[model samples]
Target: MKRYFIILAVLLTGCTKQLTQTNPNQQTAQTFWKTATDAVDGVNSVYGSLMLDGSYMRFTHVVLNTRGDDATSNSPWDQIYNCGKFALNVDGFAASAPFTAYYQGVFRANQVIESVPPIVMDTALKNRVLGQAYFLRGLYYFHLADIYQNVPMPLTIAQSSSDYYARQVSQDTVWMQVISDFTKAATLLPVSYADVTGLDANQFGRATKGAALAYLGKTLLFTKQYAAAAAQFQAVINLGVYSLVPNYHDNFTEQDENNPESIFEVQFSRSVGGTTQGWGPGDPQSNWAKYEARAITFGPRNFAYCDVQPTKALYYEFLQEPTAANQVDPRLYATMFYNTPTMKVYGQSFQATFGVADSEVFCRKYENDGFVASEFVWQFASGINSRLMRYADVLLMYAECLNEEGNTAQAYPYIQQVRARVGLADLATVKPNLTQAQMRDQIAHERFLEFGLEGKRFDDIRRWGWLQDPTKLAWLQARDPEFKTYTTGREYMPIPLAEIEANPGVIQNKGW
Candidate 1:
């Protein structure tokens, strides 16, 4: 051993520089958050998670939209089909993918929140960075609370082995933390990035004050604090930073993303960032391209595998109300591609390429049919952004808050504003003086048509308690056969079995 040690020291005698070298490409917790760029990069990493497979990249929207009566999945994969049918394969990729993706977001956000503050940087820039961190953590938890309904709550980054396994908290406790984060974010964030002075200056997708307030409102609404929710939403409206884009379809495309209507959306690019299609929680700065797989999953047929499609009920829902011109609603044309006269898919006649079968509907909302001739062109590398919130939704939610507060009449103008955009007859003229219950039904009808296949219907129905109400559940089952399989307490996706097995403190959701 002594002889070998002497020889080894002699062999490295002239390699002292190599022995002392540190890998500049590698960044660890201890070395990160040392500069303004480092802080910006940290927050950017939190945003990066939204593009991963488990997050909005694929599974999140797929399961969220498909579980509702408005959409159905016909994939060959049983796990995909199961999620839409309200029978989530708790241990499978469909369930676990999003579970891990969201926590990955939470973990990155934790790092930003814990590490960025101590760095010396421009005061305003530092605040913006921290504000985004809080907003993102809140946003991730908002989805976590709604989708899983109950999960662990960790506000700070783990510093020790014991810190890694956060004990599960009740749904309400998670909501409270979410509320706190959003509240802090609202205070620290600017209304828009237009005036921002740092790395995110004038950026379109990073969280803004309005975005934070909107989520705060949504979280409040989700938790049934109607009055509090109303205030936050009103604050967003008061910010005066957002408005509905005249062309509704503009809200769904890569070309028109982050428009005035889009309050918050995940940024994606085909040629930038990680471009790989693998679904693991790999490094954010790795080669997994900043692209979303959802377009392929929901893309129109003939060009891509149309795993998901709009339910017939959704197709007919738009038909139930003709435009003021006594013609088919234009919004319907923008939302989906079904066989119709003179209708076109990717500039090809809808009836010519696919025979007139009204029952078969494929989503057109997020596809590149308008930009590229074929979805096959992009395939898995879809650069289309995933819109998480929009001002149009805010208007609808605010109206809901008002009606729930017994101010039914005041809710009229808000819903009416959304209707007038599409040339629908004003509600005051078509259905005047609606009672509270009548207005409630009217908003449900409006939201049904306005936000189809936007990953919002399930949350809408759940919050309205439609799934638990036997009469309402029967109504849903009548429109979607998948709803027939829905049973009590299964409204929320099951907590992943892997989570339960890995953490002794965690328990499965009730129905599973």
Candidate 2:
């Protein structure tokens, strides 16, 4: 069944207009920063680029979360099964129409960063635009690090061929650039932006000091600067506006994104009218198709794409123990949809014990639940924002840092607090003697449940130094027979050959 919605107003034309008409060199820097609306349009391009799916959209969930044998499918599924082998070439990460869309955003942000110094605007507004440019640049670099790994870091707007002929830097150097950009962003941004100052509720889901600090903390953690990461993470935790949304479901709801719990989010709105087709270029024919789960525009299956199915091991973890039966983590219900019939392979429906899956399993909580047929399908064209940072991540990082610093006893309370909000009884009531491995396992498990499909699973595994563990892979296989066997030194991803050919300095990750 194709869902349809009537558009009452003309679709938003500004995005297309700005994309076609904007040229960075034509305007004087002084004239550019004279108006708030110009700055706003510059920032809007950043938001619009997010509507297109990019490298993170695929690998973040597919290769990282679903490739393990613990993630089950027969020989038939093509999308993720290919990733399971890490056979994907660098072209797998090459420039797609979607990926290129973000470059427009980077260009727009660069215009702001370059022009602001010369513009005679109110001091506060000038600072705001500068801060936003820094934030967007940091974000673009973060994505670049994840996908390209060692691409050249171009900071200023490249006005000519001379500016474009820079040498590629090392991955470590790329991280340093990201760190510097985010650090500057933190100093320039405010706690939050007002639609108008003095009105506390007027802020959009934009960047802020907290956002920059949180991204910095995550970046530092990835780079093994644990102590420094902890300090930054602590800064966000102490900022006081953000907290865990008590109801696990509330955090993913559209109404929940800009709430006090969100530090930063990619803003999305549903059926705002007309045909914006905001979900990006995928399968327009099937985008609204009833039985096509990969459509990503409608269907409970938008949350059930073939590339990032939840692992049975993950599903099992959420099934409560005898003492805790019917006490599944509230987040489990929020993160996955388990089909009762599908799990009855042993003649016992997993749902009989776990309470889900009358027929379909959907990773539904983050998507729009109120999607009426007309509103959810492609014809209606709705959007669901991705969360870039939330307060819970800060708290968890803080606790992990404290534990790592040998204050396990002090860490116990923060860990317990997160558990309490999710309806779990405190497991570490007294912070019993715990090895670093033990504490790390608990933290990893919590993150697995907390951020199931939002695409941090692989990164977390890498950061915890668990990605290449043979024993871990074997354990995953035991949970599901399809786990692809991976060996040591196969941890870094293979750079696509096309990229290596295009830029000779680029080298692939080992064991590709």
Candidate 3:
């Protein structure tokens, strides 16, 4: 299970030695890669990277959730507030933390991919491990490519110290590597590990055939290869291994992790009870901070940090579409805690708890407030698994791809599936026969509501290139005032000074 893997990661120690000396009893890189178990552990190290502070545990969600028109952050902490407004420097956690964390994932994946092949194991299991490795490497590179744009592409593990110093490459080159890795992984992965045995049993957190294919499709779609992207998404659909779960809120909480709808999610857990900003050499018997802190950071108002919330524009979008029940989109209640009358938050009426007017909006998507009496559960050890990709996302992306290809009619069915789950009116019946451009706008509206704070809005924004489009950028400026400060080249996070200082091969991104 992943619990075992996380424990194994925390328990493992770093090597320390006198100059030119080695400990004979200690396992070296030369001696470690000798068995199937080593291969499993090696790949698991990649998964462990997701739980650290820089990745899913905190900063990645911060970067992904905040820096868009959909969500707003108002942390008194400038580092937190500035990140949302695209006012980052070459320093600070916002600029560097995810950069460090994801590359750490890439490094771990590289080790597994390099070491696993010659270990003389069951062929199927070996392929599975390598497949996971490739997928994870691609996933990490995908994040790096999105955030940094132009970054180094290191396909293999370093042999010598010099090998670690990789030269920077263009974003297109990075995208090529991501597509290549995902393609290789898709070929080697299976549809499910539910029926699998041995080391990988009960490990639904691991990457699989569907995940690789979906991500590959996403990469192609992001790159504007519409036809190729459509084919990949359709291939994933043809697999029939995934579907939308009925409860939309279930996707965010710890209650239903690795469910049928989740294509890939970062695993996190709270094995120990105590939680007081737990971070040190992770203690297995004590609080080790093995939980994700995304909720606590995103937990609106008095529930947690009140650091992030829905923009007025986003809240407004939720009110535009009423479900068949004649209520405003039900997903909105699941998404945020606003000034709606009789709306209870964490078992108390909204007005009774906040004592505020109709001006403020707070997030509810990933909080533990639904189950816990207080925000204590979300403080630092919020064990909610961050769902990185889902079947719903795949459906919408497929629809977008179809619309982009001028198949506006073909896109309707996919959009209907997502809408039907939410009890919204069918587009074909209500707004019949949308043109390609109309269909594109409709899909954007759906995505904005369905995935407001789930970390997809920013990607959708960039992919649409609202920044370059005078009209769209003006609309964004209207919706989110932070866009007023956004400038050319600031869309990509600046290269951290630490990275450039450590490795001369890399250079800073423009417009820092």
lDDT of each: 0.84, 0.59, 0.82
lDDT of 2 by residue, 174-197 (tens): 889889888998998888776435
Winner of 2 and 3 under lDDT:
3
Error of 2 at 112 (Å): 2.3
TM-score for each candidate, following the candidate numbering: 0.94, 0.78, 0.93
Candidate 1, position 241, lDDT: 78
How many clashing residue pairs appear in each of the predictions shown? 8, 6, 0
lDDT of 3: 0.82
* Model 1 C-alpha lDDT per residue in residues 266-330, reported as the tens digit of each score: 88878776546656565544666778888878887887788899999999999998989998888
- Please give, for residues 323-377, the per-residue lDDT of candidate 3 as tens digits: 8789788788888888967787788888877776756888888788668765655
Q: Which stretches of candidate 2 lie over 4 Å from their true place?
A: 1-34, 55-81, 93-105, 195-201, 278-307, 320-326, 339-361, 373-380, 477-501, 504-512
List candidate 3 segments past 4 Å from native. Answer: 1-18, 272-287
Give the lDDT of residue 286 in candidate 1. 62
